[model samples]
Target: MGTTARETDRERHDEVPVLEAFTRFLGLQRGLSPHTVRAYVTDVGQLLEHLGGDEDADPLARLDLTTLRAWLADQRRRGMSRATLARRTAAVRTFCTWAHRSGHLAQDVGARLRSPRPNRHLPTVLAVDDAAQLLAVAQDRAGDDDPVHLRDWAALELLYATGVRISELVGVDVPDLDAGERTVRVTGKGDKDRVVPFGVPARRALEAWLERGRPALAGPASARALFLGARGGRVDPRTIRGVVHRLTAVAGVPDLAPHGLRHSAATHLLAGGSDLRTVQEVLGHSSLATTQRYTHVTPERLLAAYTQAHPRA
Candidate 1:
């Protein structure tokens, strides 16, 4: 159950003034988005509450490296995922650093606080043949003049071709595409814009959707959107997710989400000898580290390749 205002007040009453001030600093000074700021505040709130368990403790003054480590250990005991624990560690460290700099504490206790490295799980990706089969199924269903069928085919094709995120996919507008150049301009995280390329299959799918599919569903709410729902409005990510799930179900493959399509795209690109820097640009990743995670090949695959080709073996 969520805390009531009274419960929250009692839980955080001792640290309310400092927490409120830090939230303002995050918003006004650091310019963090409301969602991000809320996450940081919530993480910090948990830390503060943990420290406030002692009735007369000065939570701010007691914010030490020991307290920060204890908070992370407590989170681990709660069966939280390693990623969540890593984020909580970062949040608390950032909060403590800022508080110390602002004179809330005599020393920067978080300066030595280390966030745990998050576990890296290889993303679930479709093999090339599987991706081909998935798209083939969508295309088969799109053989008729149904706008819904056409949209599904194009959405899948574009997803696998460009490796764009779901938000970037659904946010595409008609003018975002350049048919002649076969590129789509996308706005990604951090409000960064880049144009990513697609292939002939995607081009054909996109053309068919725009010329036949989109127009049929184009209501006033569509507002120049590249993809439209049955109700003639811009397609929601939820609807796109349903389309992906339906496509995978029809293909008789493992349940694949939109992100799986993106993972497949990036993995295939790496397999095709695309350089990491080029792939990073294509995916609009601000950090190359993120792109590496999405496309890291297995050691087993490397060993298999060596055994097949090495003359000494």
Candidate 2:
């Protein structure tokens, strides 16, 4: 005789309207990406479903610290990771704050809600030799003058050279590149743009793609896209991932995705004496703490320097 969570969601009075408003706030006011906005909305929607309040009552009004904790506990019981729980907790907190500001809730109930810190895992990175081999294999493949092969070669080069996320890489426009300066402007999370510099090899590969490869594949729909798909549309993240995975295997290196190339680039930069702040700017990380993860990947290099420089050693 109890109302199911789905039934309660269907009968709610303000849930739909509140979620719609929250979605708009996240996208328009917060300037979050569509993917991020969808995630926050999905998390809050699940929370609303879990609340299962009276049909006439505003569910947000009933959202308090205790209710938020219970929802997170239920999520934990369902085997969600700490990272997922943390993100959900953040979503609820943001929603509660927004609802309070909009006069829907009496107060910000989730203001005190705490997110569980995610477990830190060192990301997989290829050795310098392996990365060289990967690019060498790609360069060899591009020798045939095939457009797709040339594009893949350039993609891998830019990915490792600049350490950009796949989304940023794909979103790059032809006009964004300043070839003379060897810098490309990438729009990162929250649509924030930063200029990242590439080395001579990346610049050369990119020039090849632009001069020889792109013209062969460019079509009316290609517009200003720097990288085009086989069908002449803007390159997507999935295709870039497949290209990395395929080329990584061909190079006889560790199996990895585009993100792995990002990790390798960051690690190599640190090993090559690049400072944390510089890498932070290069990777467009909002926090230096985010860039600090790469430092952990260079323990052997750290030990060598310590052994050589420290008099106490």
Candidate 3:
């Protein structure tokens, strides 16, 4: 064989500028969510950190199956979950692919990187009557017609009624609501927008809050975020979660979250005989498969309902 070859350290450190540029490119060109961008940045940063201060070798030329596998092993030793590892692997692969395409690297070093499979845990949901009772308890807390009380009831009601995610709920603007039609347009992940209708209870609560509460909370400097915080600022997702937990606890549901209400809504809709496609559209799921997971059914319950209702049975 010919003489053994190796890359210099300086060449490796030279790719730092390219990596940083690629990160900026992702933000500008991909229009990815801030959360996604942060995840990508963290993953790439971890790899760079692992490489230490070595900069003489071409980073791409030095990278190979061994270093990639070693990095994964190191992460695993540190007790990172398979899901996190998988995400990091994906980030590295994407970075490598972009680097190769942009001519920053001679070869795609991460071409063979394989992410470990992640667990698929089913989401938790609340029963219909239990959810109703919870909502009723939340409604009871309005202290003889207070706007904040009204707002809390309305928030929970809309979440359960529409099956919209908490991010979508908090992001709602005043113009998105159409009280006459009892419908609101929600922006879901990937900025996909969908119109969801609310029932009489949700409608009433929303109207009361808008008329009585929002005016009290709206500040001239504040942007048009639908839910206002205690300080008259745009409500953050964390605050929405805290509100859900606090209200749900009073309703005898200590485990409920905003997403749990969404799950409850989908399951209840399916049990109430709403077709999957209709539920899919209402939930604004980009794919039917994602929505189908909430089509919950207990085999015994299905059998009993069939036996009780079917003339043939």
Using TM-score as the measure, the top candidate is 2
Worst lDDT run of 10 residues, candidate 3, spans 3-12
TM-score of each: 0.78, 0.91, 0.83
Q: What lDDT does each candidate get? A: 0.85, 0.89, 0.79
Candidate that scores best on lDDT = 2
Model 2 residue 259 CA deviation (Å) reads 1.5
lDDT of 2 by residue, 1-313 (tens): 9998767757656478889999999999999988789999999998988776566666666778987898798879989999899888889899989999999888999999989988776667899999999999999999999999999999999999999989899999999999899999999999899999999999999999999999999999898999999999899889999998888888899999888899889889988878889889998888999888554546777887888999997
**In model 3, which regions exceed 4 Å deviation?**
1-20, 58-61, 300-313
- Stretches of candidate 1 off by over 4 Å are 1-42, 45-62, 98-108, 298-313
**Predicted candidate 3 versus true structure: per-residue lDDT over 1-313, tens digit per residue:** 5443334445435546766787786777766556677798788777866765545544456667689889998989999998898888888888888878888768888999888876655567887778988889877876467656777888988999899988888889989998899999998766678899999999988887888877787786446767787777777889778888887777776477788888889888877767789999998887998787656766766787799999999
The candidate, 1 or 2, that scores higher on TM-score is: 2
After aligning candidate 1 to the native by TM-score, how far in Å is the CA of 23 from where it should be? Answer: 6.9
Model 1 lowest lDDT segment of ten: 52-61
User: Cα lDDT of model 3 overall?
Assistant: 0.79
